[model samples]
Target: MSKLDPKLAERLRSNADGLFCAVAQQRGTGEVLMVAWMDGEALYRTLTTRKATYYSRSRQSYWVKGETSGNTQYVHEVRLDCDGDTVLLIVDQKGVACHTGTRTCFDTDILLSDSVE
Candidate 1:
């Protein structure tokens, strides 16, 4: 993300609502761990650190997940959607990925879809 190409910069700026959604999933388990938004800085930080980081719209700042909770998401890969407005992260997850101590943020999907993982 070091100085995005002109086309990519335009794309990142165009439809972003000033923020792009980032979804993290466990690669082997196929468990969707969490979904958060990333600004340019957050996106760059994640790529550089190989850790999941996001922008908190409500708090209006950067948030590196697991900084305190120890539920760190070690990013394996990051994919930008065709639209370049969303991102998917394949991660090595540890412990819970949710604030509620659940394995995934979308744990409710277990009851609804029967294939949450």
Candidate 2:
């Protein structure tokens, strides 16, 4: 029982592994929070429940964000890329979005080594 329309689901482009890339961003600030993957069922659950649900590649299961960490993401809008292979989710994020306890996942910076020739 999917809440998504059959036509819309069929139109989406999935990777060979049957997963689509989903990027979550802050609704107002437009800050990118994190990137995750979603299958059709996961996408349907997110759209229907208004919660950020993702497919865990390692766990091999559907996980609702903030379910354990209290960092839930309430979806404000969902957008599909022009290629239909990527999804962007504008959401109201609660608490820290990263498991490392950072506000977002993109905190680390890679510095170029001065020793590089």
Candidate 3:
């Protein structure tokens, strides 16, 4: 794994608990898979290992996506939002991206009524 750029690392704006949002998307299809969190170490690990790694807020530990599901996400590229508060990961996903065996975590649909007052 290569070393993380100190300057780049410093540019991130983690919240009070030291975490930033990390969004994963399908490389070519542009399908948003999931939203996770990342601390400095998690971000560094993801970039160095080229795998989608996130900080588990509930578990309070680092989690490599698909570590147990066999649905790994091979990172194609990582981009930082303009404000440096969020990260976007373009990945080649394997199998399902959601734990529910779905291709994406955002499968829920919302309905809007056409009638307006």
Candidate 4:
């Protein structure tokens, strides 16, 4: 069981401009469910409440997954990658992971990259 790094926590708190990527994975089959970002407040909320919360750059607020849609994610474990800038959450998801009510956010492919100037 790897404990969260105190130093890493310090960096995360200090860098309010930084948003660490938080990836949610299925606990049963180890499939990646979704990817989001976590700011300090969101991280604290997730650690304390065991509910997956994330920071939305566009919304400029903390978005609680499943708060409105009933697709909540109960965190089983949170792991920091070796780089300490990304996070992985092993969670028990209720239903869809996408805001549009899809099974996962990864379901749709973004074609923007191809249209880049």
Clashing pairs in 4: none
For candidate 4, give the lDDT.
0.82
Residue by residue across 1-117, what tens digits does model 4's lDDT show? 113445556754324567888999989988788998987678878988899999888888888889988999999998877766788999999988878777777768865566646
Q: What is the C-alpha RMSD of each candidate to the true structure, in Å?
A: 3.7, 3.3, 3.2, 5.9
Q: Is 2 or 3 the stronger prediction by TM-score? A: 2
Candidate ranking (lDDT, best to worst)? 2, 3, 1, 4
Off by over 4 Å in 4: 1-8, 11-16, 110-117
Candidate with top TM-score is 2
lDDT at 62 for candidate 3? 90
Listed in order, each prediction's TM-score against the native is 0.83, 0.89, 0.89, 0.79
What's the true lDDT of residue 38 in model 4? 87
Global CA lDDT computed for model 3:
0.90
Candidate 1 has its poorest 10 consecutive residues by lDDT at 1-10
lDDT of each: 0.83, 0.92, 0.90, 0.82
User: How far out, in Å, is residue 26 in model 1?
Assistant: 0.6
lDDT (Cα, 0-100) at 24 in candidate 2: 97
Which stretches of model 3 miss by more than 4 angstroms? 1-3, 111-117
> Candidate 3 vs candidate 4: which has greater TM-score?
3
Q: Candidate 2 at 83: error in angstroms? A: 0.7
lDDT by residue (8-114, candidate 3, tens digit) is 87899989988999999998899999999998888889988999999998999999998998899999899999999999999999998988878898886547646
